[model samples]
Target: MAKRLLFIFMVFILGDIYFFQAFTTVFHTPFLHNAYWCIDLSLLIGVATLIFFQRQGKDIQRQAGDLITFFLIVFIPKLVALPILLTEDLLRMARGFPPRNIYLSEFVLICAALIVLVIAFGLTRGRHYYRVRKEILSFPDLPDAFDGFKITQISDIHSGSLSDVDGVRKGIALANAQNSDLLLFTGDLVNNKAAEMEAWISDFTLLKAPFGKFSVLGNHDYGDYTRWDNAELKASNLDRLKEIHQEMGFKLLLNESIKIQNKGASIALIGVENWGKGGFHQYGDLGKATSALPAESFKILMSHDPSHWDRVTLTHDQHVHLTLAGHTHGMQFGIELFGFKWSPIQYFYEQWAGLYQKQGKYLYVNRGFGYHGLKGRIGVWPEITVITLKKSVS
Candidate 1:
């Protein structure tokens, strides 16, 4: 880890040095040049400080997130402009050391400036810019009574990182406005501590549905990321988090299944604990959750990570008609416009955002309800997903 970080630091420094030439060319003022170096030095020092504190075993999760945000805001624009500046330099070298291309340097600066404005908006307004994504899923085996069952799902609250009460209230209010038949929260309710959710209990409790609200834990709920004085303390923290879920009017499901009945017909709702691939803990038992159900039961499974859908749920003996998850948070940054969508998180999670189907089973990965490591969202806004299940004609 240390070696990788060192390599990254060296790359950052080299990139800054190369990009600074363009900065100097675009602006001839001595004051601006001094200001540029000052910001660069400050960021480098900040990185060093974070590394030192981390090695000392201090819990700097929040600080680390802030630093990452700063790095993106400062470096992404430079990265975008690097290729253009490098091309200009190569052309000049081929032409026998001619004068620098002032026009190209100016253009690169303009592009970088525009990117800064976009990043600024993401840091300020994008964090709370909630978007509602609706999908209509058709299942042939869906019960007639559940032909139009609407489900509202929000995931990865990470309440510890939330600071704006009004912003949170807006999201909760929006979720309630959907007026779905069932409400589900695929979790990360807090960031490693139960106390993070104390203030938001009332806001979340307002999320209503005609059927009921149910939830399943995510990887972050286990309190494994942070240090605890003892095992009992960590256990107690998780216990308290479970109680918070109940207080928020959500039935916390831990590897359990329940039947939701309407008009004398029913569909199964199964929720398992946080089970993820790539070193994530395997606490969920799919067989135990569906032990009492018949093979042909119309089931909607709630698992926190979408990887579960591919790794286990798809191949399980009993088929799951639909699965809802929200762990990737769409990497809190990406471009989604004009029917095109892309995010860094996609490489890590096959089913990162939106709807995915395989072998006739459906999985919808929510972007997330709250921010985490980056402190703000860019193109991938916070999400409130509403899925309508319809009975498909055979």
Candidate 2:
């Protein structure tokens, strides 16, 4: 792991050096050009520190995420500006015009301005811009008692990645303010160990719903990504994570079915362990989870990964009315504007975020309450999904 991180740090350094060299040639001032190198060196040191802490078995997700944000803020503008500037210079040559140094200087200044703006936004607004996405879903077979049942679902609260505890507390308070009938946490309460959530337990316990609070394990909850001292230690971590859910007043469902009642009417809610496509572990047993429920009963599934919905749940003999998941986190970045929503993860996972319906079955993939890897969200703001279930009058 250390070697891999070192390789990545080297690659980033080399890439930045290549890009900064272009600026050096454009400026033609030796001392001013050296200033750029100083900045690059400082950023490289930041990356090195992140890697060093990671190697020393420390949780530095927030620090690492900030470094990534800084890298993007600096590099992306140059990547775009340089291409456009070069293309314009080529067009000028074709028109019998000589390449002008002034034009290059202007382009550089514009690129610098853009970099400043990006950094300002990422640091000030990117992390705290939480959105409450309200979605209304209708089902034909939904019972009358559940017609107006409101569910607020949150997922992927990677507490270890959080740098601002106060901001996170506000997000949790927002979820509580919704006052929905039921609160469902799909998965990923922490990044790795159960201890990651120790500090935030009191904050999250404030999240309450009239019906009840229910949760399931996310891929990160198992601590599979980290190496432990022994097998027993790893097992103990997972067991403690389960107990943490109970302490938070949440019923942890592990390949089981529970009945939720309202106005003398009930629906079967099934939760399976993490079952994801690709390299993600497939510990979830859909058959075992729904085995005890009556075939004719209305059912809802709480799964961490959305890939399991179409691949396993829909194909199963027992039909599930709805599946709630949140593994994708919309890749923590994307463009959702002008009536269009897209993320690179879409190419890999068909159901990456938001709502999807096929042949009357529904899937709602929450954008996630917290974040991972890159730390701060870009275009894809952090989300708290409020879904209202309505009986179809049609």
- Using lDDT, give the best candidate's number: 1
lDDT of 2 by residue, 65-173 (tens): 6787777676556655655556656877888866455656566667767766855665556676788999898887889999989999999998877768788888988
Clashing pairs in 1: none
User: How much is the lDDT of residue 22 in candidate 2?
Assistant: 51
The alpha-carbon root-mean-square deviation between model 1 and the true structure, to one decimal in Å, is 2.2
Give per-residue CA lDDT, model 1, range 1-394, as digits (tens).
Answer: 4676677667677668767888887788999999998888888898899989989998988888988898988887887787786777788799997867788878888988899899888887898999999999988889999988899999999999999989999999999999999999998999889999998898888889989999999999999989999999999999999999999889998999999999999999999998999899989899999999999999999999999999999999999999999999999988999999998687678899999999999999999999999989989999999999998998
Which residue window of length 10 is worst by lDDT in model 1? 1-10
Candidate 2 residues lying further than 4 Å off, grouped into runs, are 1-26, 34-67, 86-90, 100-112
TM-scores of the models, in the given order? 0.93, 0.84
lDDT value for model 2: 0.84
